[model samples]
Target: MRLYWVILCLVYSGSAVSDQKVYRWKDKNGNWVYSDVPKKGSEKVKLSTNMLTMPATDTSILTPNPATPTVTYQAKITAPSDQQTLRENSGSVYVNGLVTPRFANGFQVQLFLNGKATGPKQTTASFALRDVPRGEHKLQMKVFNDKGMLVAQSAVTTFFLHRASLLNR
Candidate 1:
């Protein structure tokens, strides 16, 4: 038993002493050099054995709560169905739109005629436009949140307008 214990201690001590030693010195080029081999002007360097450790992160805070679900908005133009023709002698047009599940407060709707904004943003989806020239035009609607961020957009609706011409009278 004593011989076995002595052999075990010797093995552990030999392993501990086998650690490589580091030496630091300046090379011929005047640059610092570090290596395990000793040189004539090299000095032994003592390195700290303490290791750096980091605490485990709590992933629960990074994950979103499951209770509140995200909402996606959908919008469509309800009036002036695509490719529809209208007869408006006074050059007036009425546009209407719908948003799925309704939008929250502070959200506004904007009308686009021929790819151009026709009027200021309004809370309702309805719009009354006047002096619309007679011809084909495209209309679209967009919904914006309180911060002016676009939430939803309707597909382009194409329509034609006709008005009485004095030459035809």
Candidate 2:
């Protein structure tokens, strides 16, 4: 479903024209690099527009009945401990908690890191974040309705990510 937007956006922007040729090459670190303009000795790669073949969506999912009830809530973050230091080597953290009055119809919880929305819209009040960088970060949760309207929000929770230094190793 997410690929629909990406392909649609690319099609509208004309960034993925079928005739456009892309160059592929390996850098010093052995990572594959792709770009429109070819550097000296770079190989021209042919990419087909197979992404245009996307499945169609049913109309029933898009149209929602107007008789649904609206509910509001206030959620809070209960994990990672406010101002706590996490020492996970991989920099992963799990956040979970309860929402007051329970969740209403179509309500979803979203996690925000440093004021940026992260992860998928979920019906549960739990978030598993990966690769949190080293240093302090702020996390918050928000609940929204099926119409994408803001319903409930959690207080701002701050924490520090402690990573083992590799420079001195």
Candidate 3:
């Protein structure tokens, strides 16, 4: 039978396992027959594969991420209108902002002034920026835990400072 030869070839041909080919043909009785032996009317047939395999996948990629509320991590500036001109009082500027859900215990607000970090970390969002040179400036806020891991942030705001010369006094 063709099935018999196919199995024999698989067991005997250890190296050419995938390359093995079998033959199939019908006898004078019209009965279906299978064999590896070549016959006058036999047709070539591929080896029967009884096994299947699937690639391993990462389950994390298929799972949905947990949702986090926006209010719990919001950082917003409430003072110093963007692009507004200011006449600094005694070279001091008050940077005021609001943080939602209140800061966690060990978390602090950091102010970025003119693209540079300024002042010491504070538990409050309000800060007193002193002696800022007259020029255009940008400000933004970042929240960090006691371990210095960034948690939340606010958009950058640009403001201009104009200080009159003391010669006019």
lDDT of every model, 2 decimals = 0.93, 0.85, 0.84
Best by lDDT: 1
> Considering every candidate listed, which one attains the maximal TM-score?
1
Candidate 1 per-residue C-alpha lDDT over 66-154 given as tens digits, one digit per residue, 9 for 90 to 100:
99888899999999999999999999999999998699999999999999999899999999999999999999999999999999999
C-alpha RMSD for every candidate: 11.3, 23.7, 15.3
Location of the lowest summed lDDT over 10 successive residues in candidate 3: 63-72
Q: What is the lDDT of residue 107 in candidate 3?
A: 94
Candidate ranking under TM-score, highest first, comes to 1, 2, 3
Give, for candidate 1, the lowest lDDT window spanning 10 residues.
12-21
lDDT of 3 by residue, 66-94 (tens): 67444457888878878888997477889
What is the alpha-carbon lDDT for the whole of candidate 1?
0.93
Candidate 3: where is the Cα deviation over 4 Å?
A: 1-72, 166-169
Error of 1 at 154 (Å): 0.3
User: Residue 96 in candidate 2 has what lDDT?
Assistant: 88
Model 2: lowest-lDDT 10 consecutive positions:
10-19
lDDT of model 3 at position 81 = 76
Ranking of all predicted structures according to lDDT, beginning with the best and ending with the worst: 1, 2, 3
Better of 1 and 3 by lDDT: 1
